[model samples]
Target chain A: MKLKIKDVEFKNPVLTASGTFGYGNELEDIIPVNELGGIVTKGISLKPRMGNPPPRLAETPCGLLNSIGLENIGLEKFVKEKWPEIKKIGPEIVVNIFGEKIEEYVEIAKTLEKEGIRCIELNLSCPNVEKGGLEFGRSERVVRNLVEKVRENFNGVIFVKLSPNFTDIVKISKAAEKGGADVLTLINTIMGMSIDAENMSFKIPRKVAGLSGPAIRPIALYIVYRVYQEVDIPIAGVGGINDIKSALEFHLAGSTLIQIGTALFIDPWIPFKIIKGIEEFLNKKNMEFKSIIGYLNKKRG
Target chain B: MRFLEEKSEIINLIDLGKDYYQIVISAPEISKLARPGQFVNIKVTGSLFPLLRRPFSIWSAKENYIEVLCKEVGIGTKILREKKFGKISLIGPLGKPFPEPSPEDIVVLLGGGTGIAPLSFYAERITENKKIFFAGFKHLPSPYLLRRLEEVCETLIIATEDGSMGFKGLLSELIEKEFKNIESEYTKYFVCGPYPMLKVFEKILPEQRTFVSLEGIMACGFGICMGCAVKKKGENRYLRTCTDGTLFSLKDIEI
Candidate 1:
């Protein structure tokens, strides 16, 4: 099950998505962290953010709407506290870095590089934050410029996590690749809103939030399939993956690696269950893991 | 810090009427370790209609069964109420427990509606401190819970808005009325209730002596989701209700 994206090696293709799995140490009481291919830390910025007020989460059908505002311990605390603990968890730790300014992104990258982090997932598509997240990715020029500067600062693997929100996703995918991304993590939460009928106020006080779960699976799949056809970099598929079938759907749609997100809330053991399911699936079909990736597009072509 | 996803059997589900139901499930390990004020996140059905698990304070736990009392307020609780048989997933014994009172101190347990759940568990477990419970509700509780609470506390006062039960006024009014005689530094108060009821207690109870249990809207009842944040008193940073507390001293929080 060994795989490589740039110089970083993965034991498997099942990683826990950022924000979904906190610090990778939260569920040690339930599941072993080493079983995962990697754990993506919550979005860390240059300064600590208190996040949004109460009523941050609202349930929508088979999905969830959240406006967490990217609350984190910031860079200094993450490296001093979280990094040491997460690094001890054994899986490849992919630090998800966020910045309000383009220069902030480069600066955080420089710190992680100095700290000897092997890979980083750039968070350019966090819908909950007021600035520097989705706003930075909303422009092709900004996405390209941001990633290019980050490339200069961090010498290790870089994954540009793109959003499924507004603007041209394919163009932005190309912009990330052109700017020297090692991998493209496809699809952050799509923007959504929920209204409490009786209360007559927004369920998530911000009036807008990011939606994840099986509800956004199709949207994520389309984005992955579309981007896989256009970009040369590997696609790390996420968004609403709850089961083995959905996991493989992303794999067939051209995701080289798949991330378990909102579904982990449903069951913490899901990622491990999926890892076992996929390995079993490949053996029963006698198919190579690489051959199955992008199988739909490959067959059609 | 240790909790597991247990497939607990539905020992029984009883409709207490008035849209409230009592569910008893078997989770021996979680039940034995569960303390007062600890809660569980229940995935009520196998289907996906109600996506996230609902958090319920342990109404009571004994032997192999953990029971929770809930109202059919929304989709998740309604699904839980409608469950006829079989097992539902439960992740439990979560959050910090209500602090135990010193033997010399007198314990005052205050609750409203389903907020009585954890306090019932608390009063049942106390063998040292003298326990007094003040419960208020819009309607009278099911006779089973009413009787159980009566037995657990040395003194129990019941109040309903419509005067259908014991006292004819609010529990706050009853407590304030009663405490005029017993108010002392030796009294340690623990409150569990809806936001409005908690707000009323926050005003009447001494902040330094009161501990309030808060049940905020939650996605994951564990710390992972970062969804259950309650603002800390006089601080810019927020505390995670899932890990930091389902219980906090009244002086330590905004509400």
Candidate 2:
């Protein structure tokens, strides 16, 4: 079954998250990316980011911690070199934009609008870096103001991705909705740190990092549920969702769509598998997925 | 891109001294397309940790099968070693292939430990040319691959630091000794090993005729992450080892 958000209509509801899918061309040799719902590219900024130093990643109990610091080649290089190949993948190419200032976001969004991107996932919640990520995301006023500024310049489906570290996610999501965001992507990585006890040192290059994968599923689902109750906009649920069961949890929690992130490191074919599984699950139960979007929340006592 | 659905089955597993093992997988589609010095990124079945694919150089490719030699160093290889027959997943013959040696060229192939995998593949392909192999290991003798090297090359020289195998010295020393014995000039040298060993070869060999395969911590294996970059010599730019090379001329890379 198809799902429509604003002007874009996805063939299904399974899409790859930003920074996990790597522009969609890297996995071409092994898997077919066109079979999935869509692909959200790695975060693009005004200038190229070299990212963090070596030891940028560490494996935790059941998840991964990354301080990648948004390593990308800037919007100019992306539009010139990466876009032509990405367009051929035959899925909606949603560009994830990150910026240090309000104007930077508006400028990038306006550029992307002219470039014909199907949607724009505003990255206001990345927790890996020292500046411009959680700093802007943590404040409800700043999040609303930035969303309003981008909405003023660009006319596209604005999906505001929210951070999980906030004390009240419902407040921040309400702020985004008031500022004219079309959809909300619940729960970016939670701020977490790991220490090397023997050497009394930080395990990663940056002492503190953002945690992802199965470890963040509980928190992600909680935020998705809370935001679902407060916001009227469609939600694109992400974080720690690796299988059809986890995906179904998001759908039942009132998320209109789902994005696969940390699971991409484990299995690039997971998004495709989850898409197939959802279809089969719907067929077997003889029910349409769209009818059950928020069915679990409705039965809650 | 054409996706080949050939399932690769484990044909044989042999421990080759220390923690290393030679795993031979039979995939006709991959073997038929695989060339020397190419690598395959393997996804270990049923592994929850180290949830990324591991890249291994193709040791040998024959009729309908290809072999990958790996050491149980981390969680990925540990799970791979425990896998029995009838397990199957994705197989890719990726990256650039090794350069072919000219008929008149005398090749000196140097390798250390598991790095000898691609060298053996190169030795097997250039059967008509004069080839000399210098292999190095830690303490124990690598009988599994040593025997295989002897069958393909004109001469095979072994070196161990603990005097456990052929020559009681390093492989670099053996290369120096062999260099003095050969009166005819060798056309090219192919070296693949640890960074330190590669650094040593980069210092001694002539830049114009030497090629080295570099090893870097790779994530996507297809030049996206920009993790496997080697600085170009005399320039500030870097080339991706996954796309530009796992093999590059010695002069092209800084170190």
The DockQ leader among the candidates is 1
Q: B83-146 in candidate 1: lDDT tens per residue?
A: 7677799998899888777889888889988888999999999989888898998887789878
> Interface RMSDs of all predictions?
0.9, 3.9
Compose the digit string of candidate 2's lDDT tens values, residues B1-255.
222334467888887767889888888887888888888777666444555567889999899888988888777788778875647554467678898888888888889878888989988888778888888987766665768989888788888878888888777776667665642565588899887788778777888888998766665566545556577788645676767878999989877
* Model 1 per-residue lDDT tens digits across residues A1-301: 6789877899999999999998789887678889899998899999999999988999998999999999998999999988878888888999999887888889899999999899999988743244524577788888898899999888999999989677889999999999999889989988999999998988988999999999999999999999999888899999889989999999999999889999888788898889999999999999999989999975223
What proportion of true contacts does candidate 1 retain?
0.87
For the candidates in turn, chain A alone yields TM-scores of: 0.96, 0.95
lDDT (Cα atoms) of all candidates against the true structure: 0.88, 0.79
lDDT of 2 by residue, A1-301 (tens): 6988877888888888888878778777678788888888999998887676545666676677777778787999998889888988788888999888877888999988888876898998643243434567777888899899999988878989988675588888889999899989887888898887877988786887888888898888878887887778888899889888999899988888899987776566788889988889899989998876776765322
Candidate 1 chain B, poorest ten consecutive residues by summed lDDT: B174-183
